[model samples]
Target chain A: WLHHPASVHQDGITVEGLIRRSLEAKEFAYCPYSRFRVGAALLAHDGKVFTGCNVENACYNLGMCAERNTICKAVSEGYRSFKAVAIASDLIDQFISPCGGCRQFMREFGTSWDVYLSKPDGSYVEMNISELLPVSFGPEDLSMKKVLKIPNKY
Target chain B: WLHHPASVHQDGITVEGLIRRSLEAKEFAYCPYSRFRVGAALLAHDGKVFTGCNVENACYNLGMCAERNTICKAVSEGYRSFKAVAIASDLIDQFISPCGGCRQFMREFGTSWDVYLSKPDGSYVEMNISELLPVSFGPEDLSMKKVLKIPNKY
Candidate 1:
């Protein structure tokens, strides 16, 4: 089973406020080569928040996605479970979903979590992780029996 | 600059052989997961050789390290700007590297390609799509002045 919770802001964190924060975080993007900017925020299970932005490098394959970056931030702080995630991008107005790699990493935390996408106007859409990763694999799929066993023994 | 090359095998390939094939691909793991598994190999990177393995996840803040899986097999396809990729698991000898995450996604392809992984006996591996992903997020990062300007308007 999975857990999902709603997302909202306190102390008057209006739509404009959220978008601005995303934009501010955008400045932190490390796209040395590719100038695309992406920012993300995660609402942790314990009520704390984590923020991140895209980081790029000269080697195209060495870059990290914004979604992954946010999750890594939360993990680095010792937060394993999540309640919601919010993402904003300079590329599109219509909300976009996390990349496939991001979705897989999200599953590792908990298959049932909420995700929010922000628009330039501050309006947003909400989704569940399961909706994004339907019929997916988890640690259970690699059961202990399956993982622990070897081919043969003497 | 990082040497991007190809990998190869001189055998008639058996299941056992495939596992070793995949194991060799694990060397260049970008795994932030700390669960290290190296899958490197000798190939013909335009007549050169290279290797790779699984890279783990990062919070949406930092990122999972990059270019671990597909690079190994990339050299084999003769494309060389990373033509393909092979994968191996970081688990105890019996596991396979290519997961649904690697197949349904994990961008490393020019055209169709081959994959390999290890088995329980250090004797075999598996093979599948070397060019697993088709559409990946490859965008040029436009600068802030370009980004802030509203698009398609006077």
Candidate 2:
């Protein structure tokens, strides 16, 4: 398993533990449709861990990925800031990275958050959120000053 | 609120109740970034109700939409088929429809699933999943028989 050193590790758990959590989460995935199971584990700034597995719907558009669900659980529990997230998928041969939607979603939380993409073997490559979603649209773009205000002084 | 005559109305709840659930779900949205709150409610085949609101992440791509999250909750609870879904957003002037990704996600469950798009005032319009996402990709396309087998008998 190849490991890129994680820049911001949270909690006392080793990276292997985080990867294992993601792998464990995959068991709960409800992916009868695509049969592509994915799991994710989020490390909150407060040292709490949140994990989720992909849940597919009969309607393809209603499917929720493990990464997003993990974040949702974290947010619902009132954890906003995050240190890192590890994602695992059994699709071998290639690293399973977060989808574009997930990359953008994580951008809404922290630009420097570490993202670990892992294979079934627990080996992972690390990339920061900024690297995953460069030049992203964010909270600043939705500010009233930028969205509702005129460009120059009247 | 304008109500569409639902072809498959499960439970005795009026269509307005479903739309209201969608609107109510929007209250719990964790959308500090976009400020565009959206809510969704799903009516399971068993007449159970599941609700969700947009949960945004620092990584914008990792955000979960109300529609998808509601479906995920239902599926996680062991419900497979759905009767209908209602979505509400504060964005006025036009009715808020599911995003392309959501349309595709919902398509995974049932093509004929009723999708109601509503405004805060409760005014809404209705369309089926097939209409929202025509010529869609689905499970049949990913079947192992079609994926791994040769086209004719050897």
Candidate 3:
């Protein structure tokens, strides 16, 4: 059985249900240029769920990725820690992993995060952030500058 | 006159010529996934130039931005400090700025990097990284972590 980090069933919420919601959100994807639609669902540390889709632009450089969009949405709403993420793309026949850059971005949020990918039949594969990004770089590598900035200078 | 921070040009290297080369590199863009191709040129600290284009994927989340690709190529080749960058896109009619994520990635290399947006008429708009990502987050922010391992600490 595919495990959702946190399942919701108030009034109307289920794994299949949320996946469908996110898939519907894919329609809002602004991929006029690429025609590849993607959607992401994020579960916050506090159990709040937020969803976002790729927002493309005429200037492709300015376009936002589904993962980045979800991160920005969570950050803007004041959520820092993430418990889970689900990404879906309708273009390919099989599920694929997030790109290197997205892995870096996801690492910025935290390493304990879990990621899910959906099969066409609605089943999914699950993995933790560590599995996705092994030996990642993060806030820890910048220690020297902080030591220099502190007034104590000890 | 435009300023380049860490550029190293040979006896005959010109910014105008580099821009043209970057534009040509746009043809190599793997944007069948996004259909919006972008190419970038980086004038490195060692008087060498690097060029790259967006490599999109069927899984939209697995694509790299033109700027990130250029930076990664330079970093992989041992060039961390960037003097200037030129970006050209085929889809957008107006100037397109790098997304916030790219801005932060650029900051990781150097906060004072120079950025140029190329125009079809052979002219370009030059701006520094500070102007592009004002009050940006950088390596310094990473130093505040409670533990070096991130989310694992929680």
Error of 2 at B115 (Å): 2.4
Tell me the tens digit of each residue's lDDT in model 3 across B3-118: 34334335255767767777887889898755777888888987688999888765455568888999899989888787888788764456556767678888887778678777
lDDT of 1 by residue, A36-117 (tens): 6678877777667677898877787679878889899889989998877777776553554466578778888887887666
Clash totals for all candidate models: 54, 39, 3
Candidate scoring better on DockQ of 1 and 3: 3
Q: Which stretches of candidate 2 lie over 4 Å from their true place?
A: A1-20, A28-35, A45-50, A54-65, A72-79, A91-101, A116-154, B1-17, B28-34, B46-48, B55-65, B72-79, B91-95, B122-127, B130-138, B141-154
| CAPRI tier for the interface of model 3 | incorrect
Please tell me the interface RMSD, in Å, for model 1. Answer: 8.0
CA lDDT for candidate 2: 0.80
Steric clash pairs (candidate 3) = A34-B34, B6-B83, B8-B47
Cα lDDT of model 2 by residue, B6-112, tens digit: 43355886678998988888887898768899888899987888888888755556577888777765654557799899999988887898998888788777799
Score residue A60 of candidate 3 by CA lDDT.
58
Give a tens-digit lDDT track for model 1, residues B1-154. 1111223445333333434554655444554444444454433334344545545566533433223334534534654543233444545534344433444433433324444444334533333343222222322223223426333221
- Alpha-carbon DockQ of candidate 1: 0.10
Model 3: DockQ vs. true structure:
0.19
**What's the TM-score of chain B for every model shown?**
0.44, 0.88, 0.83
TM-scores vs. true structure, each candidate: 0.53, 0.63, 0.57
TM-score, predicted candidate 2 vs. hidden true structure: 0.63
Interface RMSD of each: 8.0, 3.9, 4.7
Weakest ten-residue segment in model 2 chain A by summed lDDT: A1-10
